[model samples]
Target: MTEQSAVLARPPLPDDGDLDLLLLIRHFELALLDLFGQGLLAGTTHTCLGQEYVPVSLRPLLGADDFVFSNHRGHGHYLARFEDPAGLLAEIMGREGAVCRGVGGSQHVYRDRYMSTGVQGESLPVATGVALHLKHTSPGALACAFIGDGTWGEGAVYEALNIASLWRLPLLVVVENNGIAQSTPTACQMAGTVAARAEAFGARHHRVGTTDIGVIRDELAPLVSEVRLENRPLVVEFATHRLGPHSKGDDTRPHDAVREAEAHDWYRRYAQSDADRFARADEIQRDRMAAIVREVSARPLSRWEPCG
Candidate 1:
């Protein structure tokens, strides 16, 4: 009967299926990092902190027959397609039970037929070759390769881009520009926009801000769809943020109190607004986070072993 309650009850909150996916992804990343604290990991790891939704939206566009080639920071991409979280944790830990059987550490994790190479832009040419093969065997399937802004300097990417366009390969290149290549920011390193570089190769291109979930769904859906439907190569640039440090090794930056406050403020606002209608989303997030904690706790760190 109160005015405030009436306003709240006027209509339910917006559907947040995508937001739910993001919550689960955040849980995954948090859990993996916790494992590192428990001494379950030996080699280095790259985190996809603020870039969860981009991969979540893009994953649905992929067909089961499609292939994905990822970069160093690719925990999100692998989890999007594959179901075995345990194997992923194991892979990062370098255990025999890992998805890649401990052979590939953080830089070389692979499983469920999905893979990420340590060498920057290495996957570009590999994915181009995969696309070429798919063109012959399974023309309907598409191949997606995810590279970071830092890797723009690599020669392999240009070679792959040139060949993919020349042959019209059915490949999707996603450049996740999180503003930094380690400590070096993109503004300092990138000479030109990634989309422009891809355009130079004659590839179809689109640039999307990853922070705006709505834009991500709208812009990327068609690019992914067209690549699958038309069997042609295309590239999408996702501008995102690195909410956390680059990795465990580096943590010496001056704390931006203002930025931290803003992040916390936004998080509270989103949580409060979405809690009423998208109740399941919140519940799923909480449950998944608990599950991740339990899973990591149950696994012993002593089992971890680097590749012989």
Candidate 2:
């Protein structure tokens, strides 16, 4: 077996409850920032600093065999499923020890069942296709596509939605509406609401605030369960935000707006003390991650080999 495949064969993910998962996500993002700043991770990384709750909330509702299709800002989604921060950091740093053999970087990360694509709206169709396959072979399995509000303008997204709804496929389309798509705000990009479009497609849809994890879990657990059991399509629009700029070197918003956005972050509204706890936990995880990086960096790169 190839080295990448061997790494993929690591034991199954542990049963990480919601609280521990949240801490891990926060720490993972901080480690990414440190790596980016220290020049260890080459290329730009889209950090989901404030929006960590979206994926963390969704992780519990999903099964191990279920698939996740991620968009550009998908480090959280990848880590949520794989739970391999050291391997992910190595991937971003282009080390041979990375999960993808050091070729995918931050924009593209792929393992056996999880995938993150760099192109906007591209994963929508890919997820639709996967859902179709599951409908025929593994009726109990579900496929989820994570897209941003900016991708709403893409024709492929609507097409995928229509197709999934028509086929009654077990699909969950998650639109992470962070208000701003890159530097452009949602108001300037799309006219109608994402809910309206899903309605027109005859797909079940839900819109929820990102502040409360309980609210998210309460709303999604049944919907996800319904999709897997009934083989239907569901769309969940999470009202979240990008805590940082669109990506590294992409901060262009006014100072006042930035402050307002940060002030209104969902995590802040959820629990004031929790924020402090997260910060403290992040410091500890960052130190642990640094040690992991050092160890991974010491290993030789996985040799490249042709796939069968």
Candidate 3:
């Protein structure tokens, strides 16, 4: 099949959906790491590589009037809205030219009036506050928080859940439960299902597989509808996995090498099967990666800027 024909055959972009944007963001994140070597280098990076479709499918449920709060694993969340690739690249590179003024690097990037990165679960409270503020002024505005399964262990998460539920704030909390929290499996660490925990706190809940973007799209649409209509909070747990090491500096030596090989093989198969997206995304990523690499490499040593 021809190149465009292959992509056209793979998966049609959802009507009124923005999933492809996340695909572009994933490529951008990977390119930044591989080409620019500018982000979380030598340190573990919580990559949102395989989990691209979840945010893409879910983002349509959010309007510009809404707010998004992201976690350490939030590259998808930020790029879905702002489209500020250069600013993110600069922040990751620790250049004084960064969006956070170099104060926030890979995990700490943020921009006002759009989205916030850099702090874990920090968005939850901020989102909660936004919801509360909207309650006072424009109760129609909604706040969405994208957090990880690992962050479920944080006291802040539970506190936010309690506060949000108590007030019935128009909040949407999504947990990207990627099976593993760092090296520890979800079964070993997560106290219980995220949905169950949220339900116990009197928050409405839904759980869906992240692998199927369609399923997530269906799961979130109605919930967002309810939040818009009722001004309530909903907790959605997306069941997925991290296809790579936790971060850049991770030592996967103790993990199963066979599993790693299998994942890589699976990725290869998927890429090859989807002839159109693979070809297009590959070319786009390659070109972008190359440019970023050249830009970073050309920077003089004396010109290096650090985030505050």
- Best candidate, TM-score: 2
Per-residue lDDT tens digits of candidate 3, residues 206-251? 8774244565677678778898778789988776556656765463
Candidate 1 vs candidate 2: which has greater TM-score?
2
My TM-score estimates for the predictions, one after another, are: 0.83, 0.87, 0.81
Model 1 stretches with alpha carbons more than 4 Å out? 1-17, 38-40, 95-97, 210-214, 252-254, 257-269, 276-287, 296-308
lDDT values for all models: 0.72, 0.79, 0.67
What is candidate 2's lDDT per residue for 180-271, written digit by digit as tens? 99999899999999999999999998987635577678888988899998888999998776778888757898887687667645444433
RMSD of 3: 5.7
Worst 10 residues of 2 by lDDT: 6-15
Best by lDDT: 2
User: lDDT tens digits, residues 1-308, model 1?
Assistant: 34223223323232466566666667767766776777855677887776776677776678788888888888878877774566776677654467776567666776555878888878999999999999899877878898888989899899998998898889998888777788887888988788789779888988774354554667777777778767778988876667766776575445782254225322334556656645567677768767755664466542535557
Q: In terms of TM-score, how similar is model 3 to the real structure?
A: 0.81
**Least accurate stretch of 10 residues (summed lDDT) in model 1?**
3-12
Q: What is the descending TM-score order?
A: 2, 1, 3
What does the lDDT read for residue 303 in candidate 2? 60
For model 3 the local lDDT of residue 205 reads 88
